[model samples]
Target: MVVERDELLDESCRGAAPLPQEADRVRLDLPRRDDLPDIMYLANNHRIAANLATMPHPFSLEDAKALVQKAEAAHGNSAFFAIRLRTTGRFIGVARYANVEEGMPVHVGYWLGEPFWGQGFATEAVHALVDHAFTHGTMDELTAACRVTNPASRRVLVKSGFQYRDQSMIRSLGAGGSVPIERYNLERAIWKSLRTWGRVAS
Candidate 1:
């Protein structure tokens, strides 16, 4: 079922008061008007643009605005968050869960600005989002995909507990070329087991 914004907010806020403290690492709050410029700059960088499917080669303010609007319009079945450093409040990247098909699985994707690529922030942010999805939503599994050549992204997904599934050739919507992509997934049961294993190991 498609989740509406009001419903998501209501559900997200239920039983828990909104925290007043600044987010020490990552926050999933709604994107704001001021974030457009930075979002475009980071998203359009050559390295990041090459990794993503839909990011334009030269991302413009218009592209950022359009993305923000689409993100806002999308409710139940998908949600997007602007990744920012808590202290600086600068846009580092974007992460999202979408294509939540019933009886199937929900998919997630994300990118980090080149400057933030090696910081482990992507893994942390994705882990939090995965926790939120499994705890708050009904999906039984989560999946993600990345360009086959991008080992950095693959490492992040592995650190977040996703297992490599298989590879497929898909048309790149951004680069306008057919590219091979590797898929990965983690079922809720497996995720739970892995967490337990980690606790025991520690």
Candidate 2:
């Protein structure tokens, strides 16, 4: 089914680009210093860290600060948001659209605090970001990957409509080495179709 339309949709910019889209329960926005405590606490879990690349084990306050700083420092064609609940204003996770270097497809990535797992928050937040990337941003396609073992992350991607492409080895910084991964992609055309169908179905 099409995801429910958010009240934030009416508040969206009519211009070429819009962001910080919201749903009934959560909204996506850039990481902030005030989010440091929440980011540190929720992100310090072994399960969360184990599934992510570059998430420091025993994730520290400094690490949280650096992430916020980095998000603040990033200029254009890149975004990182701290996902928070509207009801409680609780910081629960992060979502990003970035190209770590030139000449790379803007891949999507995200992680949520364990408590928020199985609640559809990751998929909702990701749908917002994906819509922004395809509708507002100028890119042909977006790419994503999940460790072969991470069925959960893979499900998030599939739920967001990504198509599986291939398998390869990638570094899992938290795991401290290379591991198998399943690559996925969603092109502009595919996203357009889904969006159109969503409007029609709704």
Candidate 3:
């Protein structure tokens, strides 16, 4: 779904209002200092820490603060947000788009809390994030990467309309090692086509 830039920004500012309340889901408005504690807890877990490129294995509150600070300083080229459930109003994870090379492509990344896995929250939030990126950011193609071993994450990306493109041996900047990763990409035309089909079916 292609949300207008103005409407998407307004909804983002309003915490994604009008969204379903079943899980209290909403995208992050602006990262706050209070969000650090929960972010630290969820991100440091073994499962999450393993898949991401930037999350530390022994993540600390200090680390979380530094990350928030860095994100705060970053503008147009990158953006980050805390994902939360609107109903319970609990922060569940983090999502962002960064590493944007003008006239090339934009990279999308996200990680959810362990407890929130197996639910459709990640997919829903990713869909929203993808829409936000395409509508608001300067990019025609969106790309993401997942460790070859992470089937669950691959599923999430596929459901979000990202098609697997290739595999490469990448140095793990987060895990402090080398690992193989599967890259995925989605172009604007492809995204529009998929959405059109969905609307036709519904």
Candidate 4:
């Protein structure tokens, strides 16, 4: 389930940190051109698009191509991963983190296909991404937001060590208007403490 060679993103990741981060049941790696059809199929649903701020409903193959293209051109300041099953190599969703400029707080975001909801995959993928951010980068904290109506996403953030910050509004292309969202933040110090506590408990 790994790319033998990823020229698109490899240069950006070299000497910085590792890619294809692994979780208990999933792997996070750069999306490929081959993933276009699957991405188009899974992302075209209204349910998935409504929860995300930028994704539009009726996501077509061209949109999927654009997504992979965007990932290829990210240039290491950001990382976009295609969440896939380790065993089956099935494209299930997407996850990413980015900052508007250096030294600013990076924002993490993710979305799973509708059929994959309620399976805990989202939490696992998020944990993998969070660990990568705090472990390999200098950011002191990461931020996230979910549509107010999306309890599942909110729970995923909580379960991954993010604390509720405040409420905000963002335009959702799928929803066709502005939507209320609940913001959350996870400090690197808190994340480290949680990891230590988990180790002690285990």
Candidate 5:
């Protein structure tokens, strides 16, 4: 699916890049302080946190605030978007392409509220984020991982054109320990080909 820019979130930079972009049914924008309550409500679940690396369980308002602050601080080095329903404009989750360090490959990640699961929203949101990263940023490839147990997430990555790369272990603040993960990667050439062939899965 070709992701489209519905409207520029930062109008002042009209021709530069689209700060907020849209997919078929979801919108992606920077997290805001006002979104804290929605973020906390959707992100506090042990179920959601267990599958993620750094999200703490019992996700609090302060954590939500920090998340927004961090997104604000990222400038252009990283992209953190609050996923929202397009028709209703309700915050549902978050998607990000983050820099692990100064020179490491960027990694993509996302999470949706429990109520929004099993609806293809995650996949659509990921499509939009991947498009933004390749279209606007300079990264040649994007990396991702999911818990060994997270089949749904694994499916999302595959649908977004990420190929399985390897296995690794990472500490999960929510899981309270290290866990096994399956890594995946998507190269710019692959993405460009997918776009040219119109094969990006919706």
Candidate 6:
């Protein structure tokens, strides 16, 4: 049975009390107007923007606002979440299973502040999204990609049970040029099997 988009998240995503959904270290919440400064501060780095496909360098408050608007307009066909630390409630980055291709929707993407890098936040957030997508939502597969040069992100995708799919050149609006990326895919069955093996061990 295909679950409707609105029902993609509910009590099942949390528990009997229906608290905000969180993984081991962070919770995936909606981006808020109050988060503008945090988004601007974290997303303005050249290092961070270079790794992402669409994040523009020197990100501004206006960019964050436009993003917030886009998120608000999406009708739940995708899950766009602001990745926040579970303990501190600090906004570290963003993660989601949106921006899917028209023919096949359900692609995953994420980013974290440079300070939050190397702490496994990206992997943790991704694992949570993958689990939620299979449990509370309906999707057969999820796709992801990273610039071939971005080892850190590629590692996260592999750790999240995604397999190498292909390599292609895609234009990066932020980069103002085309970049090559290694494509990856994670089938729900593969993700589930990994869970059984504790491959997704936190």
- Most accurate candidate by lDDT: 5
The residue-by-residue lDDT of candidate 1 on 1-202, one tens digit each, is 0011111222222212122112338765455679998888777776676666666778888878866655554344456677778877777877667653445567887777787877778876777666666665667888888888888888778877888899987555454687788888988887788677761121
Residue-pair clashes per candidate: 2, 0, 4, 0, 0, 0
Model 6 clash pairs?
Answer: none
Off by over 4 Å in 6: 1-19, 73-76, 200-202
Give lDDT tens digits, candidate 3, residues 1-202. 1100111111122222222223225655445688888888887786676676656678888877865664454444355666778766678876666653446566777888888888878877777777766666666788888888888788778888998889976555455787788888988887788777761121
Best by TM-score: 5
Model 4 over residues 33-92: C-alpha lDDT tens digits?
998888998989888777777786789888888778767644444577889999998999
Task: Point out the higher-scoring one by lDDT: 1 or 2.
Answer: 2
TM-score of each: 0.81, 0.86, 0.80, 0.88, 0.88, 0.85
Which lDDT tens digits does candidate 6 get at residues 25-134? 99887778988999999989877766666677779888888656545533333666778999998888877665344568577777888888889888888888777667
lDDT of 3 at 152: 78
lDDT of 4: 0.77
Pick by TM-score: 2 or 3, better one: 2
Span of ten consecutive residues with least summed lDDT in model 6: 1-10
Q: How close is candidate 3 to the true structure, as a TM-score?
A: 0.80
lDDT of each: 0.65, 0.71, 0.65, 0.77, 0.77, 0.71
Query: Which regions of candidate 4 fall more than 4 Å away from where they truly are?
Result: 1-16, 74-77, 101-103, 199-202
| Model 4 per-residue lDDT at 168 | 81
TM-score of 1: 0.81
True-vs-predicted CA distance for residue 152, candidate 3, Å: 0.8
**Model 5 over residues 40-77: C-alpha lDDT tens digits?**
99989998887877787888888888677656544443
TM-score, candidate number 6? 0.85
